[model samples]
Target: MQKTYKVQDDEPERSILARLITPDQNPGDDPLEELHGLATTAGTDVVDELVQRRSSADHSTYMGKGKVEELRLMVQKHDADLIVFDNDLTPAQIRNLEKATGAKVIDRTELILDIFAAGARTHESRLAVELAQLEYSLPRLKRMWTHLSRQAMGVGMRGPGEKQLEVDRRLAQKRISDLKAELKQVEERRERQVSARKEAPTVSLVGYTNAGKSTLMNALTDANVLAQDKLFATLDTRTRRWNLPGWGTVLLSDTVGFIRDLPHSLVASFKSTLEETRQADLLLHVADASSPTVFDQIAAVYAVLKELGIEEKDTLLVLNKIDAIHNPAILNRVLDRYPNAIPVSARSNKGLGCLIEAVGEALGREFLDIAVEVAPSDGKLLGYLSSKGEVLSREFGDESTIVHVRMPAGAMGPVHKSALSIKPSTLMDEAKAAEEASANSSEVA
Candidate 1:
């Protein structure tokens, strides 16, 4: 990867950022912060930024004629080589804008694809990004070859340019089909891998890009999964074992981050990459507490989850990067809004214990606390208790031994099969009923 904010000569791809805003929408302070970040991440030197107030995009150029002239002047002033828009544009609009501004123009979707292309490290991620890029370019191929001809073709085209266009279209479509089939196989394999781990408690980290999820993963499990401060720094999924203090071992997974207005093709292509998030028992929604647009980023993440049909999954809101927020009021405001959200700084290790305990409580909601009395010679049951549950304490008597343990609800069947008599303090009615009955038990203790 290129050094961030490197000297100009290395990559002189100077760009001017542009966006169209509308009334009844909150632009907030610095409406272009996200676009600026994206452009910088794609290794473009942002020369200047321009905004226009419009009810809707102009049909021909997306930007109006007057604004186009102004943009052309601005580009000339900055000697910009590119113009990046925050809105998705039709192919014709992109062509018109490029012609009007005398600079190469790319819309938000294309910019995001470029970033994904740069950050793709793994083979799976590279394939997914390539698929998305191909999908985005399939429709724009005509404009790319525009210099050849502009005449409309009718009743069996005859020109060499049109013939090449047809050839390119066929080639792109074939490649797109091939990519889809390959990704489908990847998705199937990922499903099997995730399903094999169904017996373990699985938790996945999900959030907006650059939200400190990788940092948290490293802090929790020493995953060493490439934690960085840039957006979309890591584009692959990584799973590791996290020991939940008293709750045995659990599997924790990290996935590609979400973004606002994420390209639909990219999301569909990355279905295999998102398999872990879909199959997870619980999701940790990490967010940056210090960002002004934190709520917007949070909403964007949910939108992506909804697209994946997992919006209803059990999720814990984790407000990360708490150490970066110096103002108590900002965090207090967030807490006021989301009272149940856990705040923790993955960098400073502040509040991590609380986060872990909260996770324990969430995963152990169906657990049962019981005291089982058994013969002193029953080492088999004792070993099971030690392995499957957390043994709180023990009592020794001349005739019997009583062991206090907290275990999953599923473990009750085996313990009952062992013909053990017990005192039960489980919260649910089912456990209570189970404790009250035992054919082999003389009485409930």
Candidate 2:
């Protein structure tokens, strides 16, 4: 079995972390936060660290010669077996770095792929992870196959054959094609499943990893999903029926968390998994408000959502882990920027009711404000109106009672069948009339 992702039986691999910070890649106060977390998650000991600040990266190698020399010395001093870069490196750059530093090297994307490849639990998720790994490594396969060419300055193995490399490339290309076809079918199946569940509104939970999404999921729906304090803990999507108090049930989904600069190939490969986000009626963008770089993490999640073409979806920003924030000023600042964001503590069950209410209000945007006229003595129909929909106001007449109600767009058909007259009404009119009635009652007092 492939067990490299977990630490070897003897000990954890000692790795020297290298990060080249360019002007555009401002990784906030902690430049190594993502990389350090990833390395720890992948079970590696950080023996040493090196950070190189540059306006532009060197084309030959990401780090400059001086920094490379410094890194080489650090590796020897620590006896590090591996080097992991915080930035994604091209195949040539990886080769150059390995040659310069004399250690195994991997980039940010490669590390992420490693985690996904290992953490993927379900068969479908495993396929997605494998496809991502294949797509990412295919471009770098040429360097890997050079040994098989048997190109030596001797008699029989004098010149390069190009036979082995070509064969491997062809095999890889064919596998990529087959994986795409299989995943395409998976995507189609996922779409059909989504279409079949059209009667239930879907609210997908998306955010940076370890943002308490699964905790909130368990709190809301008691789904019992694995909610660990780690990056990409829940890769496979899980959906649970969340019972909105006043509103009916809704399908709440928890998906794979997003990280800053997520590998493009991984995103492309998980189309079937991401389809849930796309098909969602609303997105609950959860964030770790307790983190110092909360805004940066939130922005990164948005970037991934935009990359997936769901940036404009109706999204509700949820500031989770409020219990962890000791400073009131910080929470106020988060709320100041996102005035409408709901702050909650999924662990303690604080503010979840407010979040539920907010979700109900957001989902209510799809409801139709309909004026239904029925007989004053019709107790059965009046009971249905209050139970199935929010009754805005009612005008009583000797013969008929006109009731203004807000009901889901899909539920209008059944509601209309029982009423004497049904038609769309501007919801604003009901609000204004209700306000007038309230004022009149106060004036009467």
Query: Top TM-score: which candidate number?
Result: 1
Q: Which tens-of-lDDT digit does each residue in 46-95 have in candidate 2?
A: 98889999998999888999999998998899999899999888999999
Question: Which lDDT tens digits does candidate 1 get at residues 59-148?
Answer: 999878899999999899999999999989999999989888899999999999999999898888988999999999998898967778
Task: Estimate TM-scores for all models.
Answer: 0.81, 0.80
Where does model 1 exceed 4 Å of error? Answer: 1-9, 150-152, 366-445
User: Residue 294, candidate 1: how far off, in angstroms?
Assistant: 0.7
lDDT (CA) per prediction: 0.88, 0.87
Lowest lDDT block of 10, candidate 1: 425-434
State the lDDT at 358 in candidate 2: 93
Residue clash pairs of candidate 1: none
Steric overlap count per candidate: 0, 0
Q: After superposing candidate 2, which stretches have Cα over 4 Å from the reference?
A: 1-9, 148-161, 369-445
